[model samples]
Target: MESAARNISFKEKANKALGIVPEDAIISKSYLFVSFIALLVGGVLGLLQGLNRAGLLELPLWFNYYQVLTAHGILLILVFTAFFTIGYFYAVLSHTLDGLLPKVRKMAWIGFGLKIFGFVLAVIPIIMNEASVMFTFYPPLAAHPVFYIGLVFIVVGVWMCAFGSFIQVANWRKRNKGEHVPILSYFATGVFVLLFFGSVPVAIEVFMIIPWALGWVETINVMLSRTLFWAFGHTLVNIWYLTAISAWYVVVPKVIGGRRFSDTLTRLVIIMLVVLNIPGGFHHQIVDPGITESVKFLHVFMSLAIGFPSLMTAYAMFSVFEKTAKKKGGKGVFAWFKKLPWGDVRFLAPMIAMIAFIPGGAGGIAQSTNQLNQVAHNTMWVVGHFHLTLGTTAVLTFFGISYWLVPFISKRVLTPAINKLGVIQTIFWTVGMIFMAGAMHWVGLLGSPRRTSYTTYSDHATALGWDPYLFFLAIGGTLLMIGIIIQVYAVIHLMFFAPKGETEFPIAEVEENATKTPYWTERWGVIIVIMLLVIAMGYVIPLVEMIVNAPPGSPPYSPW
Candidate 1:
């Protein structure tokens, strides 16, 4: 089979007509523009929340924090992450599949238009202080009908992109029959499956519940809606993180200059993510009064089962890094770590991603245990754990991948000085998050709660213990904001002021003897994902039933 990377050279006649701009570069730049706008909106909301938490600003008495939180969560997690991932995948697939994007130019514009319209509709009620429900869509706390409708529109736009990518892959497969999909594309498709299946329940829940909440419907079952919403929400984060893992698989090896130590292990990790990721949402409800013990335990076990894939990924990637470093003349068990390019943005991105995963993984395990969850549920500990995983690791790595891929995708030359600045900003982000999240864990474990704007200690002794941690968190927040600003500036410079120059398209050289799977096996991967989703949701239904049928005074649904 002809490698896509090996076949990307343009004919001289086409080059003469089109100049240096590749079709993929055009698509990537358009998406980057959209992502930056979303980030700006999300950042403003995040800054406001941080200020409110620190007592630096007083909101109107009638203005609740829930709407702002919802906007921030959706803008950052859904809009920004989805746009970036779409762009990145498009860029990679165009290269790996060795095909020109026939319709991505039109698709990008369409996606941007739908997204902008949806975002505006969603934010209007939020800014007007009319809808204060948080992003979780938890039952009994609803927002304006437009908010749900707008969100559905935004998701629909994303689904279009997913469908477009699938078309691209399918077309590529048709043109190049008998060829195996690249590992990265295979994993990227797995992410798309996760997103597509997960979005189904979310769409159903929002369309059903939003109208009822707004009195457009006479009656609706809030409990049933909550069950469905989480069916989507829990898997949503997994979809985001799986992309991060895919990026890691592509990136870590390149930075270290070696192949993934175990291709089978990598495939298994992707399989496990598809299998174990969705059913584990029940662990989120361990403390809820309505859920049954058996159901919660089942979730706990499934959550723990996800660890196998995580461990496999860590082992395979780290082994490749070690081997690469050793080949570069490093010695000893840990001495090769020092040979790593700590200051390079490309290297530091994956390295810090792995570092953040360590704490995130540990915290996830601790939280999944029934006994341990009793102490940490609804506390800042949960906040800290996710910030490390999603905020620092996933977001930072996405930024890093953009920095590395954007120049190639744009077919332009970015200032090396700006690239260096971007790396510094990434470091600041990693360090600041470490400090902030560590402090949050400490304070939360010491009994400080989450989701409140103010904390009033029960006694002087408790206040004394908590105050310093809060202070450190404030400082860390400042650092993180500054780092974010630096990144934003760097991106702006790259997009507008970067010099245009002729450059070689990045060509990935594969070993001639590289192990390859059959085409049929790759197509069967989709069937496997369908099976996993069925099993995961099937397991959750029994839990949902128990919660719905619980007695009024039972501990499962008690308000206390």
Candidate 2:
């Protein structure tokens, strides 16, 4: 038995030394390839929408503005982020946990197929201009029944991948009993847990909508649907965030020649985020009328509670930076920042992402306030907020990950030229987002509305005032298009044409003499139960009110 154990241990070490197993690499590569494809297509759609909104481009009636808008939101916010998160985490699981089990691998491929098939089904309607209800797809603004059906498949696909991660992690723990899961893998576990639970509300929402959309039900509860959608919507936003920060904690440290922050602190942040995340959705509905003022206030507190974990993250990251710089013999407070790598694309991109979030997070808190939300709700300000958070913070981090992750999975090296191109791409993206998002916020404060096509309102003075800012939006979109082209080229070259060599999956280690993390942190089952309880506490009352004391339902409307 001891010899058997020894041999197993040897095999696991060999697997690590040899890098990602070939079979597992294919799964990550496939997901990544599809994700970047979505980015390319979605990025194009984004530029078109930007131009149209700026009154610079007039789309043909065959493919109108709303269709483009809906598709853009779905492709980037839903498809691009979802695919990249799954792909990245799968690679993390394989690298840190030795390798994926065969069944889990099979499930991943199955999930990929389902998602692709579903995306195709959903896109057909968008192309036909039958599903212009936007990504939110809330009731009364119904899409084709097929669109909701497609969403069901996408949700199931996500669940499959989530469950596969669970199986992979559970198997690893059983094999290495009493040992803490590697930090990167631990982050992956939290991400997949959020993916599974976060998507549940959306799934339920979609199922309810399909019948109303098909006319089996004459009318639908609009507020209830919006409530359900936000439950998933807000969580989905954080799922991308958690994916971004997993790298912030694990990969960024190694790229910068630093050790990770305290292991116990890191795990605590993850637990706090998972437990407190779902309830924060209520803030999205603060402006909507169905829920009571006291309920919204309670939810405002819940939303603020989520920010605590983000603050913890901010603290942990800077500490790593200062400590690492001091070890390298840096002087003074701010001088340590200069000692850090500013040229490496892997570092440069995520660093900018973190910087963008300072304002992005602040904007989110402002929007959660009752009075402040009433000001920005359904305005260009809201659009600018997400653009900053998701477009800059989350998307740029994904770009940073791709520089290393693409080469690592492809068994190739990131060439100096490609890295240079990535740096330029990051610069373009940052400047573009700043101009566009900044203009959006300014115009929104000037009372500009969102979700409308270009209009001068018969050249009214207030409407004319927005044109200057809208022109800035066009300029930013043009720059971002250039960024996308360069980024896509870099990804393709790295995947297929870059010189063959080994690339290590860069996961940072804890500092020497670090304290051991408690085993209780590994009790995800209990953590999940607590998360569910908190979710129930947050949603039960409001959801009950929305349903039981409900207003008259509205029938489907197809304004388009």
Candidate 3:
């Protein structure tokens, strides 16, 4: 009892010293502020696209559908996710591992500036209609040279932050010799490691595209660029997944008054994710021509391999929920579910996110399969899959995190009113995604194409048949926009206007009886090397084959 008291006292002191360090808080706040602003802009643009797709709104010439589409994709997918992940994890680093190092903080600020500037530069071309290549920025559809240059800067900025995270983690290890990294910081480490390494292929792709975009090069290797992009593209998707799951594994347990499921299992999941992630990108290209059958199968296997960790995560989370509920004197399997805090926005939003992933992940696996992909690739089904996985599964969880995170950093508390508003926001987002994504999936199966403006193909029967589903898609987008408004408002209020008080940076403790995690999990160097080997195994042969037998390069075509 004395020892326990002493430990508690030390923690109190440590938290007092570390509580919402002004400088560290500012870094995360700035990132989050930008994140929400991007969401606002992108959400509006999404509404425009949805309306256009439904044939409800014909956009002006200056702001056409493709331009809106491109901007919407980049803002939400690239800007919002990137900034929020960095911001949230930086806070994770600060809270879990004491305050951020001064140098690390400086690096983060510099990275922030670079990313913002880069985004501005990229946006300019899109506004001028000089770049509407969409987020994938696929090579035969090149944008202005300046756009690619801007992406280079963004990539560099992300690298700066990634390295800063590395420095912070390393510094902590040096000071605390034989300790495991705090669970949240360990998650940050995995995310940043991915940010740095995953961006490499995209960086190379952009460099190759710049000269081609500038007309200095006559032609670009379309297939090669695509292969490289997906290498980064799918990994970027997983980066967001890893971030959301961090909250699930660490924050959710604490919010519900339970210990984390298992430290070793958790750590192992991170390791498995890092090692197996990059090659899974190939599954995105399974339907693309030029890849050999054997290589395609390899990628399919790798992609499915990535899902295994998610299943493990699912099992762990369910176990935690059941155990916690039973501890609350709830009896029976189904009845315990009723005991959870459904009214708490922090839990409600993320719990819904977890539930949404069931169908989202199922769709993803279906898309990964060769035959199924042939039907869905480049269709509205693909669009629905993206939104379901990223928009609802990842973005909703981010929303949940913001409820407490913004307050925690801003030295405020999440008020009851805002929490209730958040629950409403969660409902709006959930219903919106189902309407939009479900319609997209159904219409896509009915043979409606994506990446095009609404038209009846001169009033053709099949095209006219898609109208009802597209209208539902519009309704979903409208609801989602409403959700975005409430969410952004909640964030703003939590950041600046809520009653001044301390909000806990919730990181759950490991269960008392859990087995010790192997120290080998700490060998990030070995893990990264293995990640590299897996990536090379998945890429080298197929990449070599693509390069050696490549078709003649294609000149840039700005269809917009």
Candidate 4:
């Protein structure tokens, strides 16, 4: 290994130190391609949805509204976000730790294969309208057995890759005693760790639902199943937020020419996130029956606790930007903001996403509040909130990441045209989200239901009054779809068509040296125990109630 390392070229040597190689890069790129493809499919579906919801278009017999909506939700959130995050984590693990072993490479391939197979299973059922249960799959409105099975495969397959990468990091820990793991890897580990535990309920949900869907069971308890599903659902989106924040922590400082605030502080925030995000899912089920008030209140408390880290992140992000701008001779409060690299698509795209999170995060807290949640639950306001956070914040960051990652992995120079296109895409997306999501928020407060076609809503006076806002939603969706197309084009041009060259992968920012991270933060035992206790406090009673007072299980009924 030593001899081989010495024989490599300068760039290869740098890559070696980072623990990545051309082959590993290829593995990461493949994951990214899946993300891009999903973005394309999901984005188009979103446009169709917007049009349908505005009463501007009718669904043909072949393609009904619900199927397209189901497909859109699954593709964008499940396929695009999950695949993209895994791929990005692979890169982070390789670069921040030791480059992956050949064994780990094989593990990745196996994981990839499983996911692809699962995706095929999932999509075929959705396309056939046998799985038009929507993304929630709220059983009683049962999909084909294949839909549940496909979901299990996806969950497990992604879990496999997450587990594999974590093992590699663990091995690295064994070899390097008394050293702090790199921040990016630590962040990646936190994400997957949350996923590992958060996914249990989903795995159980799928396992149970599949048998029921297949008619192997007489019925399934609907409320119990919803509790189980939501146990994983909101946490899943939190994983996306953590991943995006990790990206910002690792890359934004470099982009703005600053240093990471403090390693100890950052680790603490991540630890807080992992522990608090788990029980946070309960807030989503506040309106659902079979859960007690005290337990629901506990869930609300946990949700508020999770918000602290987001607040911490916000402080750190703006501080880094401020310091960077000041270093370039800025004065006065907020004056530094103008000096940021706004012209750089790589920086601008995510910065805007982060900016959107300020509002998105607030809405999250509001929705989690048992009092205010009465207003937001199951409304278009909920839709608007997620659009701001996951859609704009997370999805936009993913697009920004692709701007540099494509070139970095493809061994190509990103042409100026591609960069310009990316900036244009971001603009289109930001404007689109404002019009679309803003309208959703307004109409939701006025009592508009989410997830139904506009034509159906036309029977009511309030629904008829929503026409102007619906137009805004349709227009916004159109712009956002165009943005997705432009982004896909930019990546394709960079990867396969752009001239071969070199671009530096953005590594974490640190000032020369650090003393050390807190020992408690590094130890899994401390965080794990606290997490478990908090989770128990929020969950045990409510779940027990669900099992005991649960109504008779509902037999699966096929809508198709």
TM-score, per-candidate, Cα-based: 0.89, 0.97, 0.98, 0.95
- Predicted candidate 2 versus true structure: per-residue lDDT over 427-527, tens digit per residue: 99999999999988889988889988899999999999999999999899999999999998999889999998888788787887898898999999999
Candidate number that wins on TM-score, 2 or 4: 2
Pairs that collide in candidate 4 are 19-99
Candidate 1 local lDDT, 149-233, one digit each (tens): 8888777877777766677777777876777666777777777777776777778878876667667666555555666676677
Which of 1 and 3 is the better model by TM-score?
A: 3
> Residue 269 of candidate 1: its Cα lDDT?
73
Error of 1 at 454 (Å): 1.9
- Superior by TM-score: candidate 1 or candidate 2: 2
Query: What is the Cα-based TM-score of model 3?
Result: 0.98
C-alpha positional error of residue 36 in candidate 1 after TM-score superposition, expressed in Å? 2.6
What's the true lDDT of residue 408 in model 4?
A: 79
Candidate 3 residue-pair clash tally: 0
Backbone collisions counted per model: 4, 0, 0, 1
Candidate 2: residue pairs that collide:
none
lDDT of each structure? 0.70, 0.92, 0.93, 0.84
lDDT of 4: 0.84
15 Cα displacement, candidate 4 (Å): 2.5
RMSD of 3: 1.3
The C-alpha stretches of model 2 lying farther than 4 A from their native spots are 1-17
Kindly list the per-residue Cα lDDT of model 4 for residues 82-117, writing each as its tens digit.
Answer: 889888888877766667777777888788988999
